[model samples]
Target: MKITGLMVYYYFVCHKKLWYHLKNLNLENESENVGIGKLLDETTYSKENKHISIDNVINIDFIKRWEILHDIKKSKSIEEAGIWQMKYYIYYLEKKGILIKKGMIDYPLLKQRKEVELSDDDRKIIEQVLVEIEEIGKKEKAPDNINSKICKKCAFYEFCYC
Candidate 1:
C-alpha cells in the first residue's frame, strides 16, 4: 500500500486511527476539528502553490521557493506527529532528487510557526515508520482505540467512544 502523508501523521497520533483510515473507514469528514483545519489550509496560504502531490504518496500543504515546505495545523496537541510528518516529506522529496531545506508547521489560530529540519537520524526513523505503516495496512482489523484525551476531539470519537 502507498503510505501517504496522512498515514504517517496518524501513525504518530494513533495506530488505530491509521489502521482504520487504511481500511476505508475514515471519519475525518464528519469531524468539526477537521473542518476547521481544512478552512485554515484553504484560507491561510491563498497565494502559494498548495497541495503538491507526489506519486500519490505525499501531499504537501505548500512549498515556498522550492526550499522551504509549509504545512498548516489546527493545533499542536500532537506536535511530535506533526514534526515527523514534516521530516517524512523531506525524506520523500530527497529520494525524488528534490532537496528541501526544511519544513515549517503553521498554527494560524495560535499565531505560531514551528521550523522542522530533517536529520540523518530522522531519515532512518522515518523509513522505519513507513515500513510500520505499511504493516498496519496489511492488518485484518483496526487496532484498538487509544483512550487518550485527543480521542474526545477525533473524528472517530463517536464511533470509538459513543
Candidate 2:
C-alpha cells in the first residue's frame, strides 16, 4: 500500500475518502469540480513545470527557483489539508536528501499565495498521518462517511450521498 500526497490530503479532509481512494474507487473523473481543478492545474502554470513526481510517492504541482515547491489550488476552502500536503512533500524530499525547506500554495483564481514551512512538529505530525493513512488503506471496507458541509464540494459527494 503506497501513501501518496493525495492520501495525505484526503486523510485530513475525510478518512472515508482516504479509504475509498485506497480501494481505487475513484470519483474525481465524474466530478465537474474536479474537472475544473484539473484545468486550473494544467493552465495556471507552464506545462514543463507541471506534475513533477518525487520518487513516485508525491506529485508536486511544480518547483520554483529550483528550491521552492509550489502547489496550485483553485481555492482556499480546505487550506489546512493543503498546508499538510505541502509539508508532506517537504518531508518526503528531505528524507530523500533533496532538502527542500520552502513551499507555497498558489491560488491563481484568487491571485493569492500562502507560504508553508516544514517545522519539526509538522514532520512528526506528518509521520503520524502516514501511519494512519496506511492503516486506513488496510481496512476491510471504506470507513463510514461523515456528513459535513464540505461533502457537497467533494468529488465523492455522489458516491457518499446520492
lDDT of 1 by residue, 103-145 (tens): 9999998999999999989988998998899888899977888
Candidate 2 on 1-162: residue-level lDDT in tens?
A: 667899999998899988888998898898888899999988887755689887688999889776899999999988999999999999988988888869999999999999999999998999899889988888997788888889988888878888
Model 2 is weakest, by summed lDDT over 10 consecutive residues, at: 46-55
lDDT of each: 0.90, 0.89
- Ten-residue segment with the worst summed lDDT in candidate 1? 153-162
- Which candidate comes out best when scored by TM-score? 1
lDDT of 2: 0.89
Each model's backbone clash number: 0, 0
Cα deviation in Å at residue 15, candidate 1?
0.4
Best candidate according to lDDT: 1
